[model samples]
Target chain A: MAQVINKRIILKNYVNGFPKESDMLLNASATIRLNLPEASNAVLVKNLYLSCDPYMQFRMRESKAGSFTPGSPIQGFGVAKVLDSRHSNFKKGDFVWGLTGWEEYSVINTVGFLFKIEHTDVPLSYYTGILGMQGITAYAGFNVICAPKKGEYVFVSAAAGAVGQLVGQFAKLSGCYVVGSAGSKEKVDMLKNKCGFDEAFNYKEEQDLDAALKRYFPNGIDIFFDNVGGKMLEAVLLNMRFSGRITACGMISQYNLEQEEGVRNLYQIIVKGVQIQGLIANNYLHMFPKYMEMIIPLIKQGKICYMEDIAEGLESAPAALVGLFSGRNVGKQVVAVARE
Target chain B: MAQVINKRIILKNYVNGFPKESDMLLNASATIRLNLPEASNAVLVKNLYLSCDPYMQFRMRESKAGSFTPGSPIQGFGVAKVLDSRHSNFKKGDFVWGLTGWEEYSVINTVGFLFKIEHTDVPLSYYTGILGMQGITAYAGFNVICAPKKGEYVFVSAAAGAVGQLVGQFAKLSGCYVVGSAGSKEKVDMLKNKCGFDEAFNYKEEQDLDAALKRYFPNGIDIFFDNVGGKMLEAVLLNMRFSGRITACGMISQYNLEQEEGVRNLYQIIVKGVQIQGLIANNYLHMFPKYMEMIIPLIKQGKICYMEDIAEGLESAPAALVGLFSGRNVGKQVVAVARE
Candidate 1:
């Protein structure tokens, strides 16, 4: 077997506050063995689409045992093709999506989460977002946690992001009156025009979020899909109707803050009898098959839509991941590591 | 039928901040007709035990239409005996419990919520606390919302008050380890010694609530029945375990503040996968019969306990109501206007 040159993106050190492209070092010197080690369950993959998710920022910091290690290639959800496999479930040329490194090639030891991609009709890059972890996150958070009803008012923060975009669309499909908030006019326009949101607002331009919410949802919000927590969550709390549900998917705004902003209107939770719940997509993996059953048909029928901001090449991985924190990406950010 | 002099407590005006005894004025000149008008569904009752609750503070302020009107008799849940009735469901000498004015006598037009006291085996005053709205508040907030499993760690704030005390008892009966927080040492002693809480602490005496919660809930809190929100809620958020449930019953600490204190640790809701829900006991009225079925046996068997801080007369109503904010009264605060 011929020796393949493996280009990898490795973190220089544990990050402090906002990450930068300079924090990562692109190495082209690393090489991988084409042959698998004897009896090992590991599967060697050629990475295709590397996901740049907001949660990857949490792993970059020095945390407990499970957090990403410094001087190692950062790991995240990605779409890849199996080149060699010692694992019984996966074979050569198997298209899969699971946890992988920001590199051209990755030796994956855990094959439990690696799902063999069956559908190839749509874009393979969709597995990095709408068909993978981010897809399940939006699905479970909106459908399971928020439990949207027809004609109910729904508000989603970070509405142009991967999970937020899907949640807004799901609410719309459920016959809900969906409104979304983004950081910029372009993203806000994308939400309204492209994502089919009933209304969208640039949160940065709004002087008072409470007034903005009151305007969008005159009857008060029934479901709040919160991606950016802190001040927006506080405002949403004030505007929640009786028995309103809040799906706390991510807190992108407060993740980097040393001291997170205090929510002042939590008392309204009692006043309105609201339920605010936090969710992680991994916990709801059992519902993935059911979720795919619902979403796959929608994709085929053109009843649903998704947007992506693809950055070409393995070297662009660092900048793509860093761009997520600053709201620099327009949609689902992905790094195209390889052609196939 | 003769005219009866009614000694009533009237709101001087819509209160701006923390209420004082002077904020309520005693009007002794007002009178009520002992006889019912033709075709009237009104029931004239002699008020006995009037319950003073923390939520009453919200009604005291000049807010929306539901708030207590200025220059009107202050109304609340109370135990009363029907002296005269034009309603088909009730006759003279029937013992009932429902919303009634804070006065010596009241003519209640709406008797829908007025539950006829069938189980008088217990004290009539029990209807104002253990067997009344406060009891149901604890039952619904704990059993319905928290949904505790046996041996789960339960933490209750304001744990010696009307709702908190009952919640602690319910958690204990479910085979859970219960801890409670109070403002005074005596109440703390009452929580552990009388209410059967495994542990109790005086939050006022503690220098750091986060440290206190960390020390008590070393394994983290599974269920938190919050009566006093704000800072304690922030601390509890930090100490919550995975999939923890929080019942947001009240925010007594923040109610009087010009600006409610901000909860800085709301991001923990995501970190720990917590579900924090607010409950208005009135919405769970359908569960009252089931709650009573579970509670009546506990009371009759002497398996459950309750405490009352009783005020002597109608004149004491203002002080008793005001005392709740200051944590002056122990257990359920009740004003005994007249004995049955």
Candidate 2:
């Protein structure tokens, strides 16, 4: 077996408040064998596209159940190619996506989270977002949890992000009057003009969120896909119509805060007979086959569009992940570590 | 047709913060006709037991949709006897329970809310609590929304009150480990001893609500029937189990505040895959018959017990309603206007 240098990004230390690019270090000292050890059940993978998500911040905190360990290769959802496999379910040349390390090459012992990529016609990098975990999150949160009906008013916060973008598109496909809010004008314009949202706004420009929501949804929002929690959630509670539903996906707004912002107007839930349902994409992964079946055709037909912010190399992974909090990424942030 | 004095309790002015007894005035000058006018589609009722509910606080605010009008008789769920009727559904002397004025007699123009009282085997006052909106609220929120399973841990805030008490009993009946929080030692004891709750605590005495909940629900709460929102709801969020269900039945704690207390820890909803559903008992009225079928047998078999804090006379109605905010009432607060 030939030895190869493995370049990787490791968590420098546990994060406090917002994460910084310096919190991670690119290490090129590690080396790995091209072949797996005899009798080992581990699968060796060459990482391709690494996802930079809001949830990755949670893992950067001090080690708990799911938190990333200091000095360990920070793990996230990524698209990878199997170089060698001692596992029965996978083989060489197999493309996959799931929880993988922020590295050029790695040996995965835990094969439970990994999924074999069946459809590669629509860009393998799509496995990092629209065709992967982010896609299922938006699908399950909007279509499954909220159960959006035709002609219903829908509002999506963090609407230009990976999950939010897909949620807005899904809501529109459900025949809903979809409105999205983003941080920048470019993202807002992209949401409205590019992604086919009925309306989109730059939340930073709005002084009063409640008034902004009311202006967009005068009759009141029937469904709210909340990717950013805190003030936006409080404001959405005020504008919710009777029996409205809110899907709690990621709280990107409060993830870095030492103390979470208190959500006022929860009483509106009772008054308007609303439902706030929490969503975890992993729980809905069983629907991946069905989701791909529905979404792939939509992508091919131009009914669904996805935007990506690709950072060129493995070294740029830390900055790409950190940029998510400051709203620096225009779309789905991905660090392309290798071509194959 | 003959005229008779109709002594009533009228809203003196729109309430601010917590309601005061002075907010209501005893109006004895008004009189009503003993007979219905020709072609009138109304039912004239002699008011009996008036229910003192937490939601009445919302109606006490300035006239809006579903708000009480100043100088007009307050309206609420109550048991009454039809003195005269031009509505085909009712005849003279028909016992009914629904929305009625806080008065000796009321001429109801809208008879849609009223339901004919079929069984008088139990106390007629039960119609104001166990057999009316509160009963259905407990049933729909617990059985339908929370969907309790055997061995699940359940927590109810305001557990000694109208709906909470019933919910605790129902949870117990469904083979759940039920815990309840009240404001007084007497109410706590009653919840555990009489209501069949596994545990009960006085929330007023617990300085750290999150600690109190952690102590009670060490394994995390599977179902939370929330009546008193605010800090309690926030604390409950921290202790929710994976896929936990929270039914937002009421927010009595935040009702009186001009500005609602912000509920922190909403992010837990996503972290734990929890669902917080808002419940309006009216929306679940279709389940009333099924609920009554399940409950009537339980009540007859002594499997369910309800506690009542009866306030004698229409004069005591104002005080009874005000007392709910301060936790003065030990159980289901009811005003005895006239015992038929």
Please tell me which predicted candidate would have the highest TM-score against the true structure: 1
In CAPRI terms, model 1 is classed as high
Q: What Cα-based lDDT does every candidate model obtain?
A: 0.91, 0.92
| lDDT of candidate model 1 versus the reference | 0.91
Q: Native contacts retained by model 2, as a fraction? A: 0.88
Error of 2 at B251 (Å): 1.3
Worst 10 residues of 2 chain B by lDDT: B58-67
Kindly report which residue pairs in candidate 2 clash with one another: none
For every model in order, the TM-score on chain A comes to 0.98, 0.98
Residue B50 lDDT in candidate 2: 97
What would the per-residue lDDT of candidate 1 be over residues B144-185, giving only the tens digit for each residue?
989999999999999999989999999999999999999999
RMSD of each: 1.1, 1.3
